[model samples]
Target: MRIVFIPVASPLHDEKAVQELIHQYKESVKDVDSFTHLITSEEDVQSVNIRQDDVALIGVLTGGTEHLILAIAMRVRATALLPHPTQNSLPASIEAQSRLSLSGYPSVIIKEWPPEASIRSYVKSWKVVRSLKNYVFGLLGQPSPWLVYSSGHDIEKELEERLGISFKFISLDEVYHEYGLIMDDEARELAVQITSRAVDVEVPMNEVIKSVKLYLAIRKILEREGIKAFTIRCFDIIKSLDTTACLPLALLNSEGFVAGCEGDVPALLSMVILKELTGKPGFMGNIAWVENNRFLLAHCTVPLDLPTKYKLRTHFESGRGVGISGIVEERTKVTLFRVDPLTQSMRVVKGKVISGFPQSNQHCRTQLWIESSDSIKLVTEPIGNHYVLVYGDYYEELKWVAEAMDLYLL
Candidate 1:
C-alpha cells in the first residue's frame, strides 16, 4: 500500500516556522514508506492525484488551509486522513473533516503521529475496501416476493456507487436452461460425494441429484459471465423444478464463492464484504426469533464447510427438495451484520453461539441461538429480516470499513 502525504499551509503564518514543522512531519514518517508532496499554495493542490489503493494523508500545517484540503479531497474522490503535528493543524483538521463528512465523504483525524503498526492496520482495511472495485456479483431471478424492502435496482445502484461493485441480474429461464444440460450421470457423482459427508441423509437420492444439477448450472453461469459471487431466488426454483437451491447455495458458499439465498442483494453484499475482509464464508439466514439478549437465526442452506456435522433433510417449508441441518460448535464467537442500502448504513453486533443445533422444527432446517446484548434491536429498530453471520469477531474491521465507505455504523 502506498501512502501519499499532501502538506498544506497558510502564507500568513511564519514561513520559516511552517517550513520547519513540515520538515519535522516528513521526518516522522520517513522510517515508513511514504511520499511527501508540499502544497505551499492553492495551485499545488490542483496537481495532486490520489489513486486507488493509495492512502491520501492530508497534513494540516496551518489553520487557514481547510478549504485547500477539502479541494484536494473532492478532486481525488477518496477518503482523507488528517494528521495534526503542529498547533493549528488539529483545529483545521476538525473543520475539514466535519465539512467532508457532512458532504458524504469519508475522512478521519489523527491527533498525533501514530505507531507504524496502527498505520499498517488502517491501510490494510483501506485496501480491502478498494479491492472491491469492479467485482461482479450475479442475482438469479428476482428477490423472493415477500422481500419488499430488500429488492430494487436503486439499491443495486447505490451499492455500486458506494462500494465500486457491479450487480448482474440473471433470469430464472437461463438457470433452467443450464440445469437441463447437466446429465444425470454427472450429477450422481457429486450427489454421492455430498451425501457421503453428511452424518445423515433424510432426503431421497434423486432429490439430492437434482439439487446438485442446479449447483452445476449456477457454476457454469458464474464462469461464463465472469461473476465472482451470486445470490438466487432459491424458493422459486422449487416451484419450477420440484427441487430447492438450498444444496446448491451451500455448495457454492463452501467452495469460497459468496452465494446467498432469496436473491437479497444487500445480504449478498454483506456476505461478500465479510468474505473479503475476513477469509471466511458467512452464513446468511433470517432473523426468526428475537427476545431481549437472545435471538435465533434460521435458514435452509449453510456453507457446508462451516458446520462440524450436518444432515440432509427436505426443504422445511415446501418439503420438496434438499436442505441442510448443520451443527455448529457451541460457544463459538460470532458476528452478525446487515447492510442497508436505503439508509446507507450497516448494523453490526457481536455475539456467541449459545446453541448451534436446533431442538424445534418450527423454523428453517439449520438454526442457531445467538446471544447478543443488542439482539432486541432486530425487533424494535430492524434494518431488514436477513443478517449474515460469520465465525469470528470482526467488529473493529467492520467499523473501519464502514467509516472508509462513508456509511453510518449502527
Candidate 2:
C-alpha cells in the first residue's frame, strides 16, 4: 500500500520534539513502499534505513507550496500521503527538510478533491508513469478537440518497445456519459450558479449544460476507471462558470490535483512530466499562430479566443464555391486570407478580397505567397489546389482548406 504522511504540527517551537514526531511516524509506516511525509515544523529528520524502505520523500512548506509540491513530485514512488487538516501553515524549512528526505520517485494522489472539476489531470499523468513503470507507451489520447493531435496507438507501441509495458486505447466517454445522468448536488449547484451569470441566452444553453455534464461525468469516470491523471478541454465551459470555481480549483491544486484549458496535448504532457520531475502543478503552453501562403493555423496550450484578425470580415464570394475569409493573428505571425472551394488563399493586394465582397476589394484566389525573413517573396501554386506550410514547431496551427487550393513556402 502507498503511504503518504501529511504532518500537521502547531506553531510550537521545539525542534527536537518535531524530530521525534518524524521518527515515530516514519517508524510506524516504514514498512510501506514509500512515504510522502509533510513536515510543517523545524525538526531534525530521523535516520530511517533508506535502502530497506525504498523511501521517496516530498516536503510541503508553508511558503513554498508550489515548490514543495514540485519537490515531492520528483520522488513519485513515495506512498500516497494524505494532507492533515491541521498542518495547513507549516514553515518553509520544514517543507525543505521533508523534500530533502524524499527524492527520485513518482506519486499518485488518492482523492480527487474540490469536487467541482474532475481529476482527469491526475489520472492521465499517472497513466503515463504507470505505463512507463509497466514498460508501455504509445498511449493515444481521448478524443476531444483539444486532444485531437494526441495519438494513443502511437504512444502505446512506443512505450511497449521503450519501456516494455503496453497501453490499450480506451474511451472514457462512455462512462462519462453514464455518469452525466446522475448529477450531484454540488454539480447541479455549480450549474445553477453558472446559469445565474448573465449569459447570451440566444446562444444555445445546451453547450453550457454539456460542459457541466462533462465536468460531472469526468469525475465519475475517473472514479470508476481508477485513472490517476488525464486532460480535457474545458476553457469555454470553465470560463462560463465565472470566478466562483477559481478559488475552489486553486485549493484542489494545492492538494496535488491538476487542471488546464483546451485539453492541449503538449500542455498535458508537459504538466505530467513536470509533476514527475518536480511534484507541482504543470503550467500551460503559450499561444501561437502560423501561416504560409495557403492557410492559417491557430494553436495554444489552453483554450484560445480565436484571434479577431481571423474573424470573417466578408460573406462567401459565391456563397457556394467560396468560404469565409479574414485575417489570422498568432503571437507574432499574421496573415490576411480568403477561403474558396479549392483553397484558403492569402492576400496579394491587401484589401482586394474585401472589395470582391459585392464592392469590397479583397483578393479572392486559390494561390498564396509567403514573405521570407530576407524580404524575398515566394509565390506558391496549389498542389492540386492546396498549400502545405510546415509548422516550425509542429505545435503551430493551420487551417483545413478544401481541394483546388495550393500553397508554397519561400
Candidate 3:
C-alpha cells in the first residue's frame, strides 16, 4: 500500500511551520512506501503523480487546502484527512468531510495529524474494501423456515446498488440433480479426502461419503456460476434427500469460499463483508445463551481449519445426517456481526472464545463459549438472532464498512 502525503500550505501561511509538520508526518508513516509532495501553490499539484492505487493523506496545514482537495478528488474518489490535532482545525476537517460526502466520495477522518495506531489499521482495511466491488454472491435455496423475517426476503438488488456486491439465487433442485452425474469413483475419492479430518465418525461412512459428493456437486455449481460466496438452505436437503450440507459448508469455507448455512442472506452478507475486510473466513452461529461475560454460541459446523478438535455427529434437530462436534479454544479474539437487510445495517460485537461448551441435543452440535468485554451490552442489545463469526477484533474495519456503504452499525 502506498500513501501520498499532500501537505497544503497557502501563500499567507508560514512555509517553515508547514515543513516541520510534514517532516513529522513523514516520520510517522515511515514503514510504508510513502511519497511526500508539498502543495505551496495550486500549480504544484500538477507535478505529482496521483495513481489510482494510492491513498491520499491530505494535511490541512493552511486555510485554502480546498484547491489541493479539488485537484485530488477528480483523480481519486477515496481520500482521508490528516487534520491538525487542535480545536481550530477540526471543524474545517469536518466541513471538508461533509463536502466530500455530498459530492459522493468515500472519505475517512483522522482526528490527529500524527494518527494513532488504530487509525493506521483502519486505513489498511478501508483500502481493501474500496477496491472490492461488483462481485457475485450465490444464495442456494431460500432462508431456513424460522428466519423468514430476518433473512428470507431477497434484498440482493438493494445490496448490489449500495455495496457493489451482487447476489444471485441458485435453484436447489438444479444443483442436487447434477450430483448424480458425478463419477462414482471420484465421489468416493472426494469422500475419503473429506472424512480424513474427522477424529470420530458417528454416522455411516457411506453417508458421509454421499455428503462429500453433494459438496463436490455444489462446488461445481458455484464455479460454473462464477460464485465465490454462498449460503445454503441446509435443512431442506435433510428433509428432501436425507443428508446435510454442514460438511460441505465447512469444507467450502475452509477452502476460502464463504458459505453460510440455512440459506441466511444477512448472515451470508456479514460473512462476505468480514471476508473482504480481513481476507479470512467467517462462521455463522446462533446466540445459544449468555451468562455474565461468557456466552454460549453454537452451529452445526465451522470452517474445517478452525476447530482445535473435531468429531462427527448426527444433525441435532432431525437426528439424521452429518453434524460436526468441534472444540475451539479459550481467549481467542473474534468479531461477531449480523447484517440487517431491513435497516441496511450491520450489528457487530467483539468477543473472545472463552472455551468450548458441552452441547444439548436441542441445539446445534458444535458449540463455543465466548467472553465479551461489554458482555451485558452484547446480551441485552437487540440484534438479529443469528450472527456471523470471524477470528479477529475488527472494530475499525466494520466501522469503515458501515460508513462507506451507508449502513448503520449498532
Candidate 4:
C-alpha cells in the first residue's frame, strides 16, 4: 500500500522552513513507501491523485492551509489521515478534521508521529472500508418471519448508504431449484467427505447428503451472483424441504465465505465487516442466556473451522435435519458484536470462551459459555437477539471500522 502525502502549507509561512518540516516528517515515516507533493494553493490540490486504495496522508504544515487540506480530502472521498508536524500544523489539522467530521466525512488527526504498527493498522482499516464499495451481499429468501426489525426496504437503503454495499434478494425457490440440480452421487461424495472429518455423525446419511447438496447449491449461487457474503432464511428450508441449512452455512463459512442464518441482514452485515477486518469467519448465534459477567451463546450452525471437534446432529428445534454440534477451545479470546440497522450503531464486547456445551436439547446445538464484563449490556441495552462471534480480540479493528462507516459504537 502506498501513502500519498499531500503537504499543505500556507504561502505566508517561510518556504524553506516548511520544506525542512516536510523533510523531517517524511524521514519519520520513511520506513513506509510514501511520496510527497506540496499543496501551496487550490491549484496544487488538483494535482494530487488519491486512488481508492492509497493512504492519503495530509501533511499539515501550517495554520492557514485548512481549506487546501479539506479540498484535497474531499477530492478523494475517503477517510483522511492528517499527521500534524511542528510549526502550526496541529492547529491546521484540528481545523480541517473538524470540518471534515462536521460535514460527515471521516478523518483522523495524529498529534505525534505514529508507529509503523499504527500506520499499518490505519491502512488496513482504510482498505476494509474501501472494499465495501460496490460489493454485493445476497439475501437468500426474505428475513425469517421473526426478524421484523432487522429486515426491510428502509433498512437495506440505510445499509447501502452507510456501507456502500448492494443487497441482492434471491427467492428460496431459486435455491431449491439449484438444490435439485445436484446429482445424488455428487452429494453423497461431498457428504462422505464432511462426515469423515466429524468426530461422529448422528444424523442419517440422506439428511447429510441433503445438507451437502444445499451447500453446493448456495455455493453455486454465491459464485454466479458474485456475492461476497450472504445470509439465508434457513428455517424456511426446514419447513419446505424437510432439511436444515445448518451444515451448508457452516460449510460456506469454512470455505472463507461469510454466511449467516435466519436472514438476519444486520447480523450478516456485521459478519461481513468482521471478516473484512479480521479475515476470520464469524459465528452468528442467539443470546441464549446472560448473567452479570457471563453469557451463553447457542446456534444450530457454526463455522466448521472454528470448532476443535464437531458432531453432525439433528436440527435442535425440529430435530429432523442436519445441525452442527461444535466444541470450541476453552479460554479462547473472542469478540462478540452486532450491527443494528434501525439505530445505525454497533455493539462490541470482548470475552473469553469458558467452555462449550452441546448436551442441552433445549438450546441450539453448538453452545459456548463466554465470560465478559459487558454481558449485562445484552440485557440493559440490547441491539438484537443475534450477535456475531469471532475467535480473537478484534475490538480495536471493529472500532476503526465502525468509525470509518460512521456507525455509532457501543
Instruction: Judging by lDDT against the true structure, name the best candidate.
Output: 1
Compare candidates 1 and 4 on TM-score and give the better one: 4
TM-score per model over all chains: 0.84, 0.31, 0.83, 0.88
Candidate 3's clash total is 0
Q: Write the per-residue lDDT of candidate 1 for residues 359-390, one digit (tens) a residue.
A: 77888999999999998899899888999999
Clashes of 2: 66
Q: Model 3 over residues 1-410: C-alpha lDDT tens digits? A: 35566776666777677778778767665334456577767677777777775667777776666656767755664677777764235666677778887888767777754675645665655554554464687888877788755664357667666556777889899777877777667778767766776777788877887778788889999999998888888888887777888888888998988888877777777887788778888878888888888777888888888887788888888877778887777788988888777777777788998777545777788888888865566567655677888788888778777765567888
Model 4 C-alpha lDDT per residue in residues 269-323, reported as the tens digit of each score? 8888788888889899999998879999999999999989999999999998899
* Superposition error at 167 for model 1 (Å): 3.2
Q: Which digits, one per residue and each the tens of the lDDT, describe model 2 over residues 248-294? A: 22223334544433333333333433444335443232211124422
Give the candidates in order of TM-score, highest first: 4, 1, 3, 2
Q: What TM value does model 4 have?
A: 0.88
lDDT score, residue 375, model 2?
Answer: 17
Which residue pairs show backbone clashes in model 3? none
The stretch of ten residues in a row with the least summed lDDT in candidate 2 is 395-404
